[model samples]
Target: MNHLIRIIAISFVLMPPVFAQKLVDPAAVAPEYRDAAEHRRTEQLRQRACSLKAQQAKILLRDRAAFVLKCMDAADASK
Candidate 1:
């Protein structure tokens, strides 16, 4: 139908947003790391740990956010 074609065309024109990875602060980043030469080191370590855990567990893509959040929480608690 013409209407269906028009709707599809509109949908194609209004494309879904692309996702980008942004830098995030570590939940438990130490004060020492804040002013260090490598300020992002703590967050980077947390991110690396989270990534390793996710990969080791073969976590689903949709569940990565929750898993990373919980992992950060645990890391924070350890401090």
Candidate 2:
């Protein structure tokens, strides 16, 4: 049990340096790559917003058509 505990403690100390070396700081990324990444993100957001707006417009048109049909039904019923 003591040997196992020592092994675990040694591993805990050694693991951090190995993992730390793999980390990439965002500021270290090259400028052209960062700019391209930002542009892609912005374009993706714009496309999503446009898609949502189009969906909303379709829903509004469907509702307007339903309202018009209801009015027509009322007119026909009154006659």
Candidate 3:
């Protein structure tokens, strides 16, 4: 009863995270769309760079998203 409930709760808590999106493989895409795939890869790199900057700056979790968004926008605007 109680033991079973505890085990269930523990299992749920320990479960690995599941990502909703799958990574795009550029090689798997058609040659015509390779440019689009490259763009996606570049955006992913930009996002990872922003995330690293946020972590290095020790941004609060609440403000980190906004910070990243602003960073990305700034990057795009400069292009």
Candidate 4:
């Protein structure tokens, strides 16, 4: 009876491992789902880049305007 109990206990411990091995691999995910995920990632990167570019452009424009205004003020003061 002790041997039978040990066998049952060992099987109980090993059974979950056998079940875990049946899981689907991530690489084997559906092609359409994978492609959609990739597309979303690309779109997110593109949007981030575009937003940063726009912010940089705004800063450049503001600096140019400030420099031009400073030059005009100097000219007015000289007159």
Candidate 5:
């Protein structure tokens, strides 16, 4: 019984790292964003997108893709 308790304690201690990892969304990501580096690149793109999008006075919520595309184009242009 003590052995069972020790095993359970060890399992609990070991499990948090597995469970604490971030969950990536497949559909929300583009194909090029599979790597961690690519994902980090998109954060800058998103920030640029937001700033560019904020400049427009009449941007509809449904038209966010336009901002993302423009941001991606800007990133590509810089590269």
Candidate 6:
């Protein structure tokens, strides 16, 4: 019983790192498609960042969608 408990505790401790890791692995894609895959991953990450910014600024739900789009476009414009 003690061994089982220890294993369970260890599993819970290790689970977060697995979950926190990036969802997409561009290298896992075919070489010919890797660039496109990376671009998609970057766009998703950018969108999430914009959403987080909106949340931090307390932007309302109705306004958030537009704010996120504008934020992403601004980021693209700067790049």
The TM-score leader among the candidates is 3
Residue 46 alpha-carbon offset, candidate 3, angstroms: 0.6
Model 1 residue-pair collision total: 0
Model 3 lDDT at residue 25: 77
TM-score (C-alpha, index-matched) for candidate 2: 0.34
Residue pairs clashing, model 2: none
Model 4, residue 70: C-alpha shift (Å): 31
Q: State the local distance difference test value for candidate 2.
A: 0.59
lDDT of 2 by residue, 1-79 (tens): 9999999999998885543223234455787587666666655554545545556666575565555455445555787
Q: What value of lDDT does candidate 1 attain over all alpha carbons?
A: 0.80
Tell me the RMSD of model 2 versus the true structure. Answer: 18.5
**lDDT scores of the candidates, listed in order:** 0.80, 0.59, 0.91, 0.59, 0.67, 0.90
* RMSD values, in order shown: 6.9, 18.5, 2.8, 21.3, 12.2, 6.0
User: Largest lDDT belongs to which candidate?
Assistant: 3
Residue range 1-79, candidate 4, lDDT tens digits:
9999999999898885433223234356687687666666655554545545556666575465555455445555787
Q: Which ten residues in a row have the lowest lDDT in candidate 3?
A: 19-28
Q: Candidates sorted by TM-score, descending order? A: 3, 6, 1, 2, 4, 5
Off by over 4 Å in 1: 1-37
Whole-structure CA lDDT of model 4: 0.59
Which candidate do you rate higher for TM-score, 1 or 5? 1
Report the CA-based lDDT of candidate 5 relative to the real structure. Answer: 0.67
* TM-scores, each model vs. reference: 0.52, 0.34, 0.71, 0.34, 0.32, 0.65
Model 4 residue runs over 4 Å out of place are 1-32, 59-79
Expressed as tens digits, the lDDT of each residue in 1-79 for candidate 5 is 9999999999998885545334455556867766765566567556655657646645676776676677667867889
Counting clashing residue pairs in each candidate, in order, gives 0, 0, 0, 0, 0, 0
